[model samples]
Target chain A: MILAVAWRNIWRNKTRSLVILIAICLGLASGIFYMAFYKGMVVQRINTAIKTEASHIQVHHKEYLNNPDKKFVISNTDSTVQIIRSNEHVKAISSRVIINTMAQSAKTGTGVKITGINPEDEKQVTNLSTKLIEGTYFEEVKRNPIVIGEELANKLNVKLKSKVVVTLQDMQGNLTGAAFKVEGIFRTSNTAFDKASVFVRKSDISRIMQLDNQASHEIAILLDNNENLASTNTSLTEELSTLDVKTWREIMPEVSLVESSFGITMFVFIGIILLALLFGIINTMLMAVLERKKELGMLMAVGLNKTRVFTMILLETVMLSLVGGLFGIALGWLLTFYFGYQGIDLGTWSTAYESMGFDTLVYTQLPFYVSMQIALMVIVTGIIAAIYPATKALKLKPAEAIRIDL
Target chain B: MNVIEVKDLKKVYNSTEVKVNALNGIDLTIEKGEFTAIVGPSGSGKTTFLNMLGGLDSPTSGDINIGGTEIGKLSSSKLIDFRLQNIGFVFQAYNLIPVLTALENVEFIMQMQGVDKKQRQQRAKDLLIQVGLGDRINSRPSKLSGGQQQRVAVARALASKPTFVLADEPTANLDSKSTENLLSMMEELNKQEKITFIFSTHDQRVVNKAHRVITLEDGKIISDDRKNE
Candidate 1:
């Protein structure tokens, strides 16, 4: 009966109740939508980084990371590649001859990292062949063919088929220069990476540097299933203790920092929204209780104890909050899924986002756990908001309240 | 048995600058099944006396014994429980919970006592029928007439089978016809069911129907008269 009365009491002031309900609904929807947008952006950037720059995992000479100059190449590339390829989880693997060097055209010169990669393996591992903005990718060239980022090519004032000069130290510690034709111009999502990196055939660069067939600086791996990353890394770590095996998170700690911060930031945003809604709930419930002071007093007079009175008021507030929260979750879910399908395009801001390695189109995704978390948060907020008003309702003395005219 | 006993009951209203005596040095007693009226002029403390009898307010310096229990010695929560079990109250405004139906309002007291649903429902229906509101059991307070709401309030007060009911000007908001109807119905309940009823009112109609009338002047009872007994 008390439950029935509490439920009926909410509709006593239908306009006021509906207004607060709408406010709660809109607040939750906006908060959740913003969180989904940011989560989508973070996920997109991580995916782009994995696909374009770092594969799922990277292997380097144990000392190459500490001293990434010319002398620290991995010595047994074929054996290492063979062992890694035996793992079913390894989708693609490639060995690279990396050198810090300078590329020059007739007009200009700039510092860059020249990466010597096998065309076929690099295509599967990093998919560099698909990012061609102009020209062929290491194909149909008899001489030394190089693939340079569009940013770097523009900086050096070179284009496809333009002869560029590369200066670097050989394996014997002698500064050597070689002339190469730019066979491809690639533009990746990251402008900084595009500006400072170029790629060449590993055989061609290694022969010029007088290095053995086994010499390579880095081995990149792409996994068939991203979920197998930890197990595969642990297995590879045990299999090859001489090499340093690092996941993308370890290779790019800044990305991991951003990913973790996104979760915290999402909760903070929701907390702020819920806090604002908390005040509104408190105000509405306070009015509801105060307006019925006489009725509440009569309830007390008619044998309703303090505990039951308190429970009645609290139940009303909780019911109101849950009703509004469910509607808000449904609305937010609808909006997120609809936009997630169509994609929200940041057309004018693509360049700014691409510079930060984020994709222009954001696809919002709200996990089931996150939705459940929001439901729990809203219920807690309701409970907290009800406390002050319930206490006030319990404080009304039946003697004074019944006789008091208003 | 003496259902109510008051000895030198005193209630003083201490304001910022004045201390007015709302009830002054009153001694009263009433037996079971008595239809009594405490009649007084404005500011004569009739309402105060009723409030104290119903355990609604505490007297400044007095002892009130209701049905063998000293109400003044009980804690606030204990007093509320004692009142719920021992005394019923009917307000001038007929303060029924507006959201609840007439039947639910009558069942409210029994529900608070943790009575089973089947028993409370049948008892509430019989009581509503006794009050001539059986047909209006499902109507909310807002839908009922002023007299009907007051009858519902009476039924609710009697739902707990209290030792005595304290009515403070219950007919103040009713018309002459409704007032006559309510007073006679309450008189019937008093005589037929042996339900003790104590009222504080200035209404001549109520005072004429009461078997005993205690008139107060200046917060002190001046006359205790019994008629038609």
Candidate 2:
């Protein structure tokens, strides 16, 4: 009976109840959509970093940490690659001969880390071929083929098939210069990373650096299962004691920092939205209690105990909040799912997003746990919001309340 | 058997600016099956006395003993339980819960008593029928006439099978015909069920029909009259 009364009481002022419902629904939708957008942007950053640069795990010569010169080339690169390929979880592995050099075009010169890689191996590990924006990716380019980022190409004012001079120190610490023709121009989500690196053939760099056949400075591995990242890196480190192995998270701590900080940012955003809605709910319920003071008083006079009275008011408040919350969650899910498929294009803010290491095209992805957490948050907010109004209703003295006019 | 006893009942409305004595040292007793009217002019303490008697308000210093228990000594929650079990109240405003039908309003008190739904339904229906509102049991208070709504309030009060009924100006808003009909029905119930009916009113029609009349002036009983059959 109390539940029945509480349910009917909400419809007493149909317009007011409807307005509250709409407010809660819209508030939740906007809040959840914003959270999904943030999550999408974060996920995009992590995927870009892993696919275009880090490749899950990297192994370097132990001496490279102290002296990253040409002298620190891996002593047994071929055997290491063979061992890595034997593991089922090891999806792909690429060896690289890395050299820091200054590249100069007709227009300008800038510092760059030139990576020498086996084109087929690099293709499997990083999918470097797919990022090609212009020309080909080392396809039948016989001599001195190089791939540069679009931003770097623009910075140096160079185009496809353009000749550029790269100056580096050889094994004997003597300045060595080589001219290279650009075979590919690629662009990635991170403009800073794209502008700082270039790729070339490992055989060409090994001959020029005067290192042994199949010798390289770095080994980048892409795993079949990312969830095995920690165990795989640990196993590789223990098995190959002479080299240093690091996961993507360990190799680039900034990406991990951004990932963890986003969780807190999501909670803060949700809290602010729910707090604003809380006061509106409390105010509406308070008014309802005051408006029905006489009726409530008569209920007490007719033998409805204080506890029952309090529970009824609380039940009404929770019903109102949950109704709105459930609708809002449904609305938020619809929008998120639809946009997750179609993707939200922030093309107008592409430059800003790229600068911040995020992709412009965000696919709103909310995990099931996040959705459940949001529902729990709304229910808790509802229960918390009901406390004030329920207490006020409990404080009314039935003796005097029954006599109060209007 | 005496159903209610009041001893030196006093009620003072105290505030920072003034202290008004609403009820001043009143003493009274009501026997079983008595239809009594506590009549007074405005500000004569009739409503205050009725409120104290029903355990709705505590007296400043008095003992209100109903069914051999002093309600003034009960806790707030205990007093409410006591009222539910022993006393019924009919208000002047015909305070039937507006959200409920006449049947629901009548069933509410018995529901609060934790009576079985089947028994509560039958008892509520029979009470509404007794009050001549059986046909309008499905109607909400807003859909009923002033007299019909009040009759529903009366049925609601009696739903718990209380020992007594306290009606405060129950007919103050009724027409002459409705007032006469209400009084006749209440008198018949008072005799048939052997239930005590106490009311505070200025209506002469109610005072005339009551078996006993206690008149108050300035918070004191000025006349206590009983009608002989």
Candidate 3:
């Protein structure tokens, strides 16, 4: 009977219940949608960056990571190759010879980081070969030609077959280099890469830098399973007999730190939204309790007890929250799915995003737990919000309330 | 046996700056199976006295012993339980839970008394029929007439088979003819079921029909009269 009374009383004023429901629904949907979008963006960037910019692990001489210019060769190149070949998960290996050299066109000259690799193996590991736009790929030309970044090509105004001079410091600390024709212009979807990286053949670079019979600076390895990243890196280093190992995260602490901070930021934002909705629900439910004070008193006087009254009010609130939460989950799911499918075109900001190695379109898909979190938040808050109102109703003085007019 | 015994009872409602005495040092006793009426003008402390006797309000200092227990000393929750099991009430406003149907309202008190649904249903139906409301069992308070709603309230008061009932002007909202019908039904129940009834009101028809009458003035009893005796 107490439950019946509470149900009827709630319906007596429909407008108030509706207002509270709308607030809860919107809060729930916004929290779910925003979390999904931000997380999707992070995942997308990581996937693209891992696929195109860096491999699972890189093996280099300890000095290669720090000094970067030290061409001091490691011993047992064949033994290191044996270690790499022994791991079947090590799908591909692109040996790189990196040098900081000045490139000169007839009209311009600029400093560039040149990376030389085997054309077939490099393509198997990175997306660079597929990005060739205005010129022939590295596989097409055999004159030991250079593949320039799109931005570098623009700055130098040298298309395919254009003559450009390259200079580098030799073993004697003297500048030793040679001129080569421009084989291709490639853009890595990352402006930083397009402005800086210059690809050449490993043999050609060894001949230029006078390191015959020696492995290049680093061996960038791709693995079939990504979960082996840190472990493979360690094992590879242990087996290399002469080199150090590094995962991309270890080599780039700033990126990992940024990712961690973004997580904290998302948690904080969700906390505020949840707290606000919880209080809103409580305030609204308490007002309902107060307004029905006399009615509750009448029910008590008619023989209803505190426990029954408390249970009744709690049932109403929980039911309302479930309805509102389920609706919000459906709505939020739709909003996220629509955006994930069509994606947002950032054409105006494409260059800026590409500078960071992101595609022109941003697609966001929510994880399963994000929706669960939203549902869990609503349910927890709903139950918590009911406490005050139920307590007040249960504590109502039957005599005082029974005597109340109107 | 006396169903209600009030010995030197008092009640004080304390506010921020003043205390209002609703019931002041009074003594009264009412027997079982009696249709008694408490008569007074407005604000003469009749409602306060009734509330105390029904265990709805605590005495400032004294005893309200009903069914061998001094209700004034019992805890709040115990008092509520005692009231549900032992005393039924019919308020002046008809106080039927407006949301419930006539039958549901009647069954509510029985439910609180921990009666099973089947028994409660049967008892509620019989009481409603006794109150001449068999046809209006499913009607909500708003859908029923003032007399019919009062009938429902009366049915609810009797649903628990209490030792006694307190009716605080149960006919205040009824028409003159309907008031007569309601009083007759109460008198019939008092005689046939041996259910004790104490009505606190100023209505002449109620006062005359009751078997025992008590008049109050300024929170003190002025007269107590018996008709059949």
TM-score on alpha carbons, each prediction:
0.92, 0.93, 0.86
Q: Which stretches of candidate 1 lie over 4 Å from their true place?
A: A82-89, A136-143, A224-228
Q: Against the true two-chain complex, what DockQ does each candidate achieve?
A: 0.62, 0.67, 0.45
Question: Which digits, one per residue and each the tens of the lDDT, describe model 2 over residues B1-229?
Answer: 9999899999999865799999999999889999999998889988788888988889899888998999989999999899899888898883887888999999988989999999999999999999998898899999999989889988988898898999988998999999998999999999899879999888999989998999998888999999995
lDDT (0 to 1) per candidate: 0.89, 0.88, 0.80
Report the C-alpha lDDT of model 1 over A253-345, residue by residue, as the tens digit: 888788879767978888899999999999999999888888888778766789899889888998898888888888888888987898899
B4 Cα displacement, candidate 1 (Å): 1.9
lDDT of 2 by residue, A175-214 (tens): 7888889999999888887898999899887777766776
Clashing pairs in 1: none
Report the Cα lDDT for residue A67, model 1: 88
Q: Which regions of candidate 2 are displaced past 4 Å?
A: A62-70, A82-88, A234-242, B16-18
Pairs with steric clashes in candidate 3? A191-A355
Greater-DockQ candidate between 1 and 2: 2
The sequence of per-residue lDDT tens digits that candidate 3 reaches over residues B103-201 is 998888877778899988998998888899898899999999888888888888888888898898888778899999999988888888889999988
List fnat per candidate, in order: 0.69, 0.73, 0.40
Residue A291 accuracy (lDDT) in model 1: 82
